[model samples]
Target: MAWSADKSYFFMLAKLLTYSIFGIDARPVEVEVDISPASMPKTILVGLAEAAVKESTHRIERALVNSGYTRPVDRIVINLSPADFPKEASSFDLPIALGVLAASGQLETSLFSEYSAVGELALDGVVRKVRGALSMALQARANGKKGLIVPVENSREAAVVDGIDVIPVGSLAEAVGFYTGVLPIDPVPFSWDDAVEEHGTYPFDYSDVKGQEMAKRAVTVAAAGRHHLLMIGSPGTGKTLLAQRLGTILPPLSAEESLETTRIYSAVGRLEEGESLLLQRPFRSPHHTISQAGLVGGGSIPTPGEISLAHHGILFLDELPEFNRNTLEVMRQPLEESRVTISRAVGSVTFPASLMLVSAMNPCPCGYRGDPKRQCHCSPMQIERYLSKISGPLLDRIDIHIEVPPVPFRELSARTEGTRSETMREQVIVAREAQRERFGKDGSLVNGTMAPQQIRKYCKLSKEAESLLKAAMEEMGLSARAHDKILRVSRTIADLDQAEFIDVPHLTEAINYRTLDRSSWTQ
Candidate 1:
C-alpha cells in the first residue's frame, strides 16, 4: 500500500473503510490506493472488482481535474479488499477518488480514518446518489465508525440510524474540503415524529366504499392478527377495493420496523429522493403473470422479489385464480416461514417476507354464477375447473376465507355510511397493544406468526369450545393445519374482543370465516 509522491518519499493510504451491499445486507470493504512513477500513466483495478467498478478510473480522473485537482501523472492502482468476492457498481467512485488524493499527498487529513464515504461521481465532479446508503450507514455505525459521508440527497436516509453523524456532500470538492478541514458542514438531524407528521394520507379510505360490511369485518380481523385473507365473490363486488384499503386499517409501523423496511427498499434503489423513511405499512400487488423468480427472488445477482418488497406490510394478489398454479403454490412455504431463501451459483440470500396476504377471486369463470341478478351461463364443470386452479395446500395456509357476497340494493341505497377506517384502525391498535404485552416488545410479531408451541400455550380453548371444534372437524374433515389455523384465528378474535380465553362465540365466528375451507373447494 505504498506510493511514491516524488521518488524521494513513499506515501500510504490503506484501510479506508467503506461498505458494499449484497442482497439486503452490507459487507465491509477496505479500499487501498497507490500511485507510483511508471513508463506510462494508466489506472488499473485489482481484487476481483466488477466491470462497472473497474470503469470508475476514467470517472475519477475526469472528476479530479474538474474539481480543481491535478490528475496524478503516475501508474495508479486501486484495490478493493477481500479479493475473493467481486464488487458491484459505481458506488466506489468517490471512495477511489478520495483514496487517490489521500495516497498522492494532494489531500492530507488527520480525521480521514473516522469517516466512511460512498457516492457515484459525475464527470463534472457532482456527487450522485447511490443505492443502499442506509445499509452502508448502518454498517458504518455497527463497525464503530464516527460518521458517514454520502450524497446530499441521501443524508436523511443514512441519518435514520442514530449515534452516527451523516455528512452530506454535494460534490467531490465539498467532500475533499470537509475531510481536509477546508469546509465545515453540519450534519442534518432526523426526527421520527417529523416523518410521520409530514407524511400525507393515502388517497383511498373505508368511507368511500358502499356496503361490504362482512368483507370489512374480515379485513379488520385480519389486520388485528396479521392473518392472511382470501375473498371469493362476484366480480362487481368491492373485494378489490377492500383489499386496496386494507393498509388504511392496519396499525402504523413502529420506528424500528420503519427503518428495517426502509433499508430493504433502499437496497433495491426503490426509495425516492427526499423520502426519508417508509412511515406506513406497504401494500404490494403484483400482476397475475409474474414469474416464480419475480414473485420470489432469483438471478445471478439475486435481487429482492415481490415477497421481499412486501416485508412488514401487505401483499395483495388481485384476481387470485388467474395466476399460474406454480406461482400460487410457491407462496406456501414463505407464508409459513415468513422469509424466502434464494440460492444461486455464488451463494444464497434470505429476504424477509413477513407480510399479510390478501387475495380476491370470482366464484366461477363467468363471474355471474352466484349473482342474483345476472344469469349463470357456465356449467358446473367450468366452475370446478376455475376453482381447481387454487390448490388445497395454499388454501389451507390462508387463515380466513370469507365469501364477499354482492352488496344488496337496499344497503347500497342507504344514505348512512358503515364503519370508517379510523374506528377500525383504533380497534386494531388496541388489539395490537394487547398482543405486544402477550408476546413481549416485538410489537410487529402477531398471533398469525405463532408456532405450534405458541398455539398450544396461548390459544387455549374452553371445554364447550373444544367440543364444538371437535364436532366441526369431524363433520368438515379439516386437516391438522386447518385446525391450527382455526385456533390461530380464534385467538385473534378473542384478542379483538379483549377476552382471556377462547369462548364459544369466538370459536364459532372463527369457524364461519373458513367458508371455502369447509366447502367443496378442496374436493
Candidate 2:
C-alpha cells in the first residue's frame, strides 16, 4: 500500500458486527474493516451485504466528508465478521466511515476496538436510530465490549439491558469524540423499580365495563390460566370492551417476560423513541386485511409477525370471521405450540407466541342471526359458511367460547357498580401464584398448556365430574383435543376457587364455555 503525501501512515482498524433480534432474543455480530491505497479508488463491503448495507458506501462517504473527515481516495475493502451470516441495515455506515478515516491517519483507532458501534448515518452526518437497538446492546455486552455508541433516540431502548453501558450520541463526530476521549459521555441509567411505580397499570380499568358479569368472570379465569378465549355475539354487544379489559385483570409481567416482549418490539422497529422497557404486556390487533406473512412472519430473512409481537400478552381478533381463512388457519400451530416457526430458503426462525388469544365474531354475516328482537335474514348455508371459515382444529384449541349477549337498555343505562381492575387483578394474581407454585418456575406449563401427564396429575376430577365431562364430550361430538381443553379449563376454574380437585361446578363452567361446539346451535 502506498502512503499518502501526509505520510501520517493511517492504519485504523475498526470492529464491525451484525445484530440478531429474532423475536425478543438479541444476538451480536462482529464487523471488521481494513483500508488501503490503490490506483483505483473504490469501497466494497462484503459479508452477505443486503441492499441497505451495500448502499451504505455512499452514505458513509458523504457522512465522513460532512462530519469534517475525509474519505481516503483509495481502494477500500470492509468485511463484516462471520462472513457467512447476512448483514442488513444502514447501521454499518458509521463504523465503516470511522474505520476508513482512522486507517487514513485522519483519526485515532485505539479506542475503536473497545466499543460496539451502531447507528445509521445521514448524508449530512447525523446518526439516526436503527432497529434492534436492544439486541445490539445485548450483543455488545455479551462480547465483553466496554460500552455501546448508539443514536440518542435509541439510548433508552438499549439501556433496558442491565450491565451494558449505552452511550447516546447525536452524530458520528459525537461518537468519535467520546471514543477518543475528546468528549466524555455518560451511560444511560435505568431503574426497574421506578419503571414499575411510574407505569402502575393500564388506564382502562376493568371496572369501566358494566353489565357483563359472566364475561368478566370468564376474563378473570382466562387471565389467571393464560387461556385462549373466543366470544361470539352481534355488533355492539361489549365483546371488544370485555376483551380490552382482560389485560387489566391479568397480572403484571415478570422482569424476564417484559424484556422478552421489549426485544420483539425492538426488532420489528416498533419501539417508541426514547422508551426503554415495555413494562406492560403487549396487545396486538392486526386488521383483517393482513396477509399470511403479516400475521405469521415472512421474508428472505423471516421476522416476527403479529402473534409474535403479542407474546406474553393478548392478541385480540375482533370480527374474527372477517379475517381470511388462510390467515386464521396459520395460527393453529402457534396456538397449540405457543411459538411459531417461520421457514424460508435461508433458514427457519421460531418466535415465541405464548399469547392470550381473544377473538370475537358475530353469529352470522348480518350480526343479528340469534337476536330475539331482530330476524336473521341470512340462509342456513350462509351461517354455516361464515362459521366454517374457522377450522375445527383451531376452535378446539380455544379454552373458552362464550356468547356475549348485548345488554338491555336498563342494564346499559344502569349505574356502573362492578369490581375494579385492582381488585380483580389481586384475585387473578393470587390465582396465578397458585398455578405458578403447582407448575413451577417455567411459566409455559400453565393450566391451559398442560400436557396429558400434567392434566391427569393436576386435573383429577371427582367421579361425578368425570362422568359429566365424558357424557358432554360424546353428546357434543367433541374431539379428543376438545376433551383435553375441557379438562384444562376445568382445572383453571378449580384453581381460581382454590379447589384441590375438579368439582361439579368447575366441570359445568368448563362445559358451558364450549358454546360453539353445541350441535343444536351450529345446526
Candidate 3:
C-alpha cells in the first residue's frame, strides 16, 4: 500500500454516530477512526471506556478479518467522542469496525451519516445481541437519524419505538452489504396496538386461591389504589399464593406505562428474546438474600435494580423479615419518592421505582403465634424480636396490613371458587378511571401516593366516617403517618364502591387493616 500525505492520507479519517447508555437514557457518542502511516502497525482505543468496552478491539479485529475485510495495517486510532464521561459495554464494536473499514477505504458507503449502529461482533462475523438497543433506537430517532441498525436478536425491542426504522442484521457482512447498497433489508414491522393487546394477559388469577376471601378483598383494595400491602400468616397459609396473583387484578398496563417500564427492563438486558413490549404489569419477587444494590439499582455503571424492574407493577417480598434489615431499610426513600437515586463516584443516576410492594411475614419466629390449629413454640420475647425486624417507619409506608389464616379442609376441598380476578380487575379499572378523572389522564397520582395537601383536598370524609376514624385513632395510638394512611385507604375503598365521600363502612374497613399497630399484637 502506498500513501501520500496530501492525497490518500487526508481521506483516511471517518466518523460514525453511536450511543452509550447512562442510567436508562442513551447518550450520543461519535466513533472516530483515523488511519495514519506508521513504522509498525498498531491500534489504539482512546476514550474513558471500561474494561468491557476496551476488550472489544480484539473481538472486532477478528470479526473484520473473518468477514473478508482487512484490518488497517497503519497506525489506527479510534476515539469515542465526549471522552470525559465513562463508557461501557461491547455494543460499540459494530460501529467501530465499520468506521475502521470506511477509514481504510475498503468499504464505500454513505449510510454512516444517516443511521446509527449498535451490536457486538462475534469472532465468526455474527452480530450478537446487546443491551439497551431500545434506548439506543429512541436516542437515534430523537437525533433525527433515519434508522438504527441492530442485531437480529434485538430488533423486536428496538422496533417497538415508532417513527424510526430498525434494520435487523445477522452478520457483519450483512450490515456492510446494507450500508454499501449491495443488500436491502426491510425494517421490522411493528403494530403497537396489536402487540399490546396480544400480550396484556396474565397466567395467574385470584380465583385460583381456594380460600382467604378477606385477604383477597384487601389485596383488591391495594391494587385499586397502588397501595403497599403486608400479610402475616403461618406457613402454607396461601400468603404467597395470593401475592402472586395480585397483578391479574390490577389494571392492565397502558401504552405509556408499558413503554416506561419496558425501557428499564431493556436497559438491564432483562427482556426475553423475541419479546417486544411488556404489556402485562410486571411482578418481581426477589429473594430475601438480595443486597441493597440488587434491590434498588447500583453498580460501577449504575444499572437498574429490581424495584425499577418492577416499575408500574408489583414487587412482592416473601418472607419479609428474612431480608437483611439494612437492605430493607434502604427502600424507605424509593417507597416514598417512587424513584431511587444511586450516587457513585462517576455521577448519580435515578431509576423509576413506582411499584406496589406486597410482602408476607410470619406472626412469630415459630410461625404459629396466631394459628389456632398449630401450637406456638416461640416465647413472647422471641415473637417481639421477630416482629421488630420490620421497622415502624417502613411499616408506616405500607398502606394495608391484614392477617392471612390457614385454609380449613372444607374450604380447600370445596369445588366452589372465590372471587375471580376478572371481576376484581373490572372494579379496579373503574376506580382507576375515577382517579384519572380526579388527577388528570396521566395516572401518575393514586390514593397510595397522595401528598399531604392532596389528601386534605381529595379525601373528604363523611360525618359518620370522621367520627369512626377519630375513635380508632385515639384507641389504637396510631401515628400521624398511620392516620394519613387510614384516610388514603378509606378513599380507595370508597372509590371501589363508587361513592363520592368516605363513609362509615369504608372507614371501618380501613381501620381494621391497621392490624400490626394494635397494642396487643406482640403479646
Question: Which numbered prediction scores highest in lDDT against the true structure?
Answer: 3
Candidate 1 TM-score to native: 0.94
Candidate 2: misplaced stretches above 4 Å?
A: 6-27, 474-477
lDDT (tens digit, per residue) of candidate 3 on 45-65: 998989988899999999999
Per-residue C-alpha lDDT of model 1 across residues 1-523, encoded as one tens digit per residue: 4545456444565458788888888888888887766537888899788888978889899999999987877777888988877788688899889988888777888776899999999999999988899999999999999999999988889988899999999999999999989999898799888878776367778987899887888899999999999988888799888988888888777787788889889998888778889987888999999999999888777788899889988899988999999998999999988899988776788998889999988888888866889987988888888988999889877899888888899988999978899989998988888899999866557988888998999999999999999999999877778899999999998998999999999999999998776756534
TM-scores of all candidate predictions against the true structure = 0.94, 0.95, 0.97
TM-score: which candidate is best?
A: 3
Instruction: For residue 509, give model 3's deviation from the true position in Å.
Output: 0.4
Candidate 2 lDDT tens digits, 221-261: 88888889999988888898888877777877888888888
Error of 3 at 20 (Å): 1.0
Residue 272's lDDT within candidate 2 is 69
Model 3 lDDT on a 0 to 1 scale = 0.90
Clashes of 3: 0
Error of 2 at 500 (Å): 0.7
